[model samples]
Target: MMHPSESCNHRKSLFNTMNRFIGAVNNMDQTVMVPSLLRDVPLDDVGDVKTVTDDTASNGSACFQQDADMYSSYVLLKSIRSVMEWGVLQGDGRGKERVGESEDDDLEKQFHFHLNGLHAVLSKLTRKANTLTNRYKEEIGCGNL
Candidate 1:
């Protein structure tokens, strides 16, 4: 079992990291505006404000979703890598080599397996994000504005 002090330290670290991420996400909408392709941005009208809001909300939500998904995938991959690295360091990586279970040999196979799964998820997310981006571009409604 983890000592009380160790547990408290771990919790504090997690909370700090989480707070930073939350702060960034909360301000993302204002930071991300229309693309530079539209140089004639009109901020003088209420209509423009409405359009910007709609576009920003959609795009920001899509971005946050993609970021969250990718972060989760990255976390999973890193966790697996850390475990494998630790096992290698301990010289007990091979669960049962004589039984044809070579750790080094299977490492690549397992890594690829996990990587392929992550790739599939990221691919889907990219497609979705691209769609959202395209929609935002369309909302800009400026073929040459």
Candidate 2:
């Protein structure tokens, strides 16, 4: 059992760590945009303003959907990583000796399992993006510009 001051300090530390994690997640959300390849679709002149045809609009929507899916998956992976990191940090504290050694081992195993799964998903997303980019290049008869 923790003394009153020790419990208070522990809570404070946890709060600070949570704040940092939330800030990191928010920063990632703000900075990560859809790949430029997805956003480089050309627009056609329609009256004074540029516009996309129905087919082009549909394609653009599909690209946006793919981008959203990738981004969400990436965010999920990051969140998991952040939580695992926080767990490691906490384990480094007095809690490590208090918490059974087996618990730490189990946590480490879970972290690795989730990390590997997320990496696989991220790899597939990268491959899909690359395939789309190559197809676009072939259709346009020009390399990525």
Q: lDDT winner among the candidates?
A: 2
Number of backbone clashes in candidate 1? 0
What's the CA error at residue 144 for candidate 2, in Å?
9.4
Model 2 misplaced regions, further than 4 Å: 1-105, 143-145
Per-residue alpha-carbon lDDT of candidate 2 for residues 45-123, written as tens digits (9 for 90 to 100): 1122223244424532222232243333333435444554565333223233444456556798887786666555444
In model 1, the worst 10-residue window by lDDT is: 43-52
TM-score of candidate 2 relative to the true fold: 0.29
- State the lDDT of candidate 1 residue by residue for 16-114, as single tens digits: 434433343333223226334323332222221112233324533222222233232223323333443354333333443467565777788888786
As a whole number from 0 to 100, the lDDT of residue 65 in candidate 1 is 26
* Top candidate, metric TM-score: 2
Q: Residue 131 in model 1: shift from native, Å?
A: 0.9
